[model samples]
Target: MAKKNSNDNGKTFTTQQGLNSYIKGICDIMRRSNCAGALQYVPELSWLLFLKILDDTEQREAEEAEAVGDSFADSIPEPYRWRDWANPQGNRRLNLQMGQMGQFLPFVNEEVIPYLKSLKNKPQATPRQKIISEVISSVERVRIDTETNLLDILDKIHEIDYIDPTHIFPISQVYEGLLLKMGEKNNDGGQFFTPREVIRAMVKAITPQVGETIYDPCCGTGGFLAQSYEYIRDFLADDITPEQLKTIKLKTFYGREKENLIYPIALANLVLHGIDYPHLWHGNTLNREVIYGDLFQDAPPQFDIILTNPPFGGKEHRTVQAQFAYKTSATQVLFLQHVIDSLKPGGRCGIVLDEGVLFRTNENAFVQSKRKLLNDCNLWCIVSLPAGTFVAAGGGVKANILFFTKGKPTEKIWYYDLSDVKVTKRKPLMMNHFQEFLELLPNREDSERSWTVTREEIEAKNFDLKAVNLNTKVDEDKSTAKELLDFIEEKGKEVALTLSVLRKWER
Candidate 1:
């Protein structure tokens, strides 16, 4: 949203190139100062961008009101709105002169931020407005340690004035690019930022329709839902009626996330991608056996499509795990059960899971969960990714993208290995890497990197789906390193037992 003001240069820097250049420039400024890494940079940057968008949207709303002959009012009070305080040329600029550093720190840290925190946006404030206040209250100004850096960053933000229809899409990419940089810099952020390319691939594979309900239970940063909206929207744009579009915009994508920091980020991500008024909850998605009616009253019934990359290796509390049939602290195991129960009959899903879940003989829970997946759902495909895909975040364990549908037993499961392809942080995984896999997915065909095995065969292996890549020749000469290690450990135990007997005899 935007307003035509006196300084409206009418210069629409509406290209992704311009947005990228601006982001790069701002990031460089942050780095040159003490802002340092992306973790230190993005939180503050996100808030600043949010405030600017809010002020711009408010002005656009004001103009719309006047045009329709309705009286206009602002969500934010005067002297505190972005234009009043942040704009140097506006009626109420901050105490600091354009580039000066006088009382600017207190004005922001004491007055401005506090005012935002206290804002009610009130009695009849829209739910969207409530989200703004909630998100702002949770945000602590992170990298504004210096007056000059803060002022400079604010001024740079002021240059961008495109939150309206024509520019929002490409601009959304800028925000995603910033998050991508954060993920690359800090693997911890990876939990929030699944590679967009990977998400897009999953979305394409699932093929969510416009009227269908799509959900992500462990939705970190709302990546899956956002991309699903984009995919469904594009696929239906030509033939969609207004009512169908209304359904798409108002109630299509839904999500739930655990971390407060990431929850708001997920909401913001969805909104920036044009899914305004997102139905994403900021809480643990696994609180109850069934989520909607109990944990979230506003939530809908079993969704038609589910896509997610649940956090790998997270251990839920036993109390939380107690609700599952095959109870386990493992987050992936719990989420797998959650997804299975959450999907409607005929509902299809694409999810990411760690390698251990595929073959964990030590844990009966893991085996049971895999059995449930195959027995209760049609787990049609598994695309095994390279080990280094998530290695930066210490996720050295290989992973797979599982595509399945509810309401049928899995007769056959197809596996595609991308293990040979190196996917390090410096050289990250991309959509192109999945091209061959995608082409083969529809047919569920067998190839050099892909093959299928029956459920009976998998059952024979104790539900261990980590079958060797059929394409690779088996090594028959020497035992594998792990097997050799196991042998050594067993031999060492025997030697220790022998030593104890000899010592007892000597005594």
Candidate 2:
């Protein structure tokens, strides 16, 4: 638990360490319960954290309304409210804890969850109520195995003060850390997450402004959209108006997510990041299928800027492929086509593409897609990411970041290579690694690591946009045959000695 210190005003504040410890304690209890994996625990935790924060926000709003002698309405009603049932100090929670042994669990499963899920179906549900409904839409019951564990988790979560200033950092950042666990190796969450450093670099290059709409067609847990919000908020901190702030918070960010599990997570994530309204569509982006689109109803047909890392190495059905201009089973390629068509004429995009999408010319779909990209957009820059860059996400494919603006054909392309820098799971990619790349990006400056390619050259090579470094020379091995044989013999002796020891141990 975080050690709480009382401020001069008598309000308690906790340090970042305290907040981290609290989250860790909650995860420990979750592991002991039913949600042992990131996939299981993250979704379960997202809803709980969301409700806790929402209740805090509403409580503050209600107090302000009372001070002004105005009416206040809560989106959640009665025992369904976190204060009513989840808060440790609340009378309802005290009664439940003091009642029949397992009563608390049944109330949550039968009454609370059902009432929350039914909010969207109400005759005149508010937008906030609808958002709440969609957030917990897939949650049939509490995932925590026992009442004791659930109650303990709630108590720890309650300690997190969302409205207080003492924490220094946004509580949303703590949630981002939890999302990172989902992207860790063997978690099966890489499909929904892009590395934060990569997202930061992309969002920086795109530099989305306050008035322009930003989008991600396949926004996993809403990382791109959330980071864009942070970037814009910080960038406009000095001169931004209240109306512009409102625009940025309520009307700027938009996205589409397909997974039943991930869609709600994306909503909760953006809300935590302070986006008052995240216009995210719940559906398959490629096929234009709508699972639920109430939040995205107000989104523009074309956005001013887009930043996304679409899923890699995914195969789509032909029926889905039939929707795109250049038909391909590869999900990335189809997404490229969709992004190109989805942008306004002068709109810009920053996208992460695997080497296959960049260099695979044999397939007509790949070649045609690249051709369309060059013809419709200014293919300005490509950053070749190092191998094992996505090893944490269980992906081993080499990848690159492509930045382009719609409405103009390609004249020349600037390429920056970070592939030479070795990336490993222990030493992951970071923002500082792109120092030289960003410095040179403004002018497309040439260096050993950076170079430019002309349109004519790309056409001659059938539009292979792979970042091939021309300045670096390959060092050829020139060991003598005798030396190689002696080295092999020494290794052979060591292997034989190890095997002999193993045989003796077996006996």
Candidate 3:
């Protein structure tokens, strides 16, 4: 019982499928425009959709308020609202008929954006107000010059039927899909996204409880935090109480991001998912002065659960490095220490780090970090991912998810090798793929990819957390490295092609 229709967008699709296809249609339009890549295209589309949704939400809120006789001040002014200008015929200032591009574009450019930009200057702006202002300031300019392209894209965006409750999840999927595409582009925007499947697996295995605080120190687009929320919400089923729901909404999830452009998207993403203006700080988590300084009420020093995929193998400035006692510029090492410090005594952590963190003795920083991790935490499991795990992020980096608990040192660490499966943009790793690992996790059962090594064995190995799949013969790294190189090379060619196709937008 699904609707079907042949349209210019593509083949016939059900409501959810059609909405998802509409998102791709917008991307196809952006691909032909001045937008250089998915990084540019995704954010532009996100803001437009966000505005439309905001407009719809406001209209509903206004109606409900009037029904209840409650006073409500609209977050956005009438002139800046989406309904005020997007429709040519309905717009009071645009006196134009349907199919006409009258003052819609101009109103967005001259009136709406300017109003958003000016809000930060107002005295005593709320956190939500500050976030809206931040979004407007960091988002890219509209690069689609042709009116036809602009209007066509609008047609696709307008297909998001906010009027129906059934459309909410599908519309959200449309937004998340666009973000995933941005991450897949492996450009600056790619930094905003972690592969969602990996995040879901981490959240599921860790299983955050209700009323417990969940946090992500380097929450790019809030993938881990959002997944954690979704995991708990579904797990509780109808058993979730009103007070518990309030706690989840107002206090459960917390995060911070350093990127200016990415931070706003993180806010928008979490807000869209029902956490009312989440407690995500827009600053470096490693910066003691910024993080420790009284900034946000939501920014806490410790957490019940920490889930994150921090940037890999990067160095901090010497000035920033001085903040940590470790006295090294290695970013991931510093983040590891921060996580350890940020967790409550019995708190759990699921973090992603490069393989070098486990075994690299060349630098004292890496060795020290591993030593600290082993000594202070019960390092339960390490899921060593496949080579192409992050191909969308431009390279094949061998990484692992470190699942641990504070207050107890690790006696025996469990390891799982998931490197056999090939993952790429076209073929992604799904949730079902993790079922095997999940089944074995609770009992610490031994299997081909799952095994246990005593802490004494780890200590003898100098805290080197490499491929510990002892039962089977480990393959050589040559093929994996070569495949990764080939993948990167192909990405480069795609970028070159994209440049050629979108060269006209460069001006």
Candidate 4:
């Protein structure tokens, strides 16, 4: 018989479905409590989940320390621990629940939240304590309206055991599902998340090693960094040394996020993904404003690999634009310049850029940025993604992935076009979509779907490096009027029959 986990309602669950259903139940409660959207609820859930995981991790550590007759000091002390306050069977929770009807919410808001938020201010705060403070920095108070709803959420969160091997998937993946909800259309979190498939392909192409520093200038929910960690861990497998593992977990990934709502979520997301120390600076990367740099202290001056999808189509202020060599209000153009300058000599980068950056020579900044990229890096490959690729994330812009290496001037550039391939919210761009591109990426081979453009040719067109597939045949519409009318009639009959059935069902 498999080990089972029981929720507060006495229902037992053991599989991913059970976990997902449990999470959905929590979300349903959150919805009724006014956290109706992912943007509203995910931030509230992130801190709760982070504390739960933190307490769980410390509990295991305490047990291990006892086994070795060593002392253990938890980063979160006393009543602030998740077990003390969040767990239903815990002494503090039982006391509060049994003593008064409405004490739990006040206690959490007044005592527990402030305590966690003040961890970094302590005279002798551990690194873990500092991390806990940073992760909950944006959380002012529990957003769930009623005490009952908040308690219910806590109960469900407590049931999630991160160390349980019986569960088929990692609990971290459950947090990823929450982040995915944030990225859904109209959630307004699409800006924080790139499609996971895109991040995976970029990480695979970059092939970041265990020791190589990987950074994301705009790491929304730390997806690129998390995926890179998984890639490196899987690449090394059993051959990985403890030192290398420590480096990967503690020092390998770094990022900067400006949004108050997103920075803490990024920390929690990366921590849930097993990054113990995600050296993320909470600040505006463009304007060089440092909101909090304690976690990012001692970070490398430059990185070995940068995988990012900088926010698309946002205009920066003059202060931000002034910081970049290429003065442009276009956010993506400034980010491109930052990525270029942040790369170490001979470093590689894989970045997602919109179509405007590729073909827009009207903007001097765009042309200058492209020129700098070509002059400073080996502009290896550009994969033109199809339209509606980001429809699930509510993005409608046509985008491309640019793969390049610094310390080498561009001679020629390979281009892989998937613009003809149709994608929608229902049908997203998958890893298999890049099958031919990945296979031909090594030698820069030319196929009907792939081509190359030389630097000289690009300069002739004033550096318009858009992937214009020369081999794609533009087929002429040769059907007669009668044929077209027949085709339309057939489709109209199908639609009429469907509507007629639907009308009968309505009755």
On lDDT, the candidate that comes out on top is 2
Cα lDDT of model 2 by residue, 317-433, tens digit: 889988888887788889999999989999999999877788778788889999999999999999999866776665556789999999989999999999876566667799998
Task: Give the number of colliding residue pairs in candidate 1.
Answer: 1
> Model 3, poorest ten-residue lDDT window?
1-10
Error of 1 at 269 (Å): 1.9
Poorly placed runs, candidate 2 (over 4 Å): 1-14, 165-169, 185-187, 473-507
Q: Which lDDT value does model 4 have at 86?
A: 87
Worst 10 residues of 2 by lDDT: 1-10
Candidate 4 on 445-504: residue-level lDDT in tens?
999999888899999999898888879988776879997786566445434533442343
lDDT of 1 by residue, 394-481 (tens): 2445678899999899999988888767565566688898899889988988888899999899988899878468687544548689
Please give the TM-score that candidate 2 achieves against the real structure. 0.89
**What are the clash counts of all predictions, listed in order?**
1, 0, 1, 0
* TM-scores for every candidate against the unseen true structure: 0.84, 0.89, 0.84, 0.89
RMSD of 3: 7.2
Q: TM-score for model 1?
A: 0.84
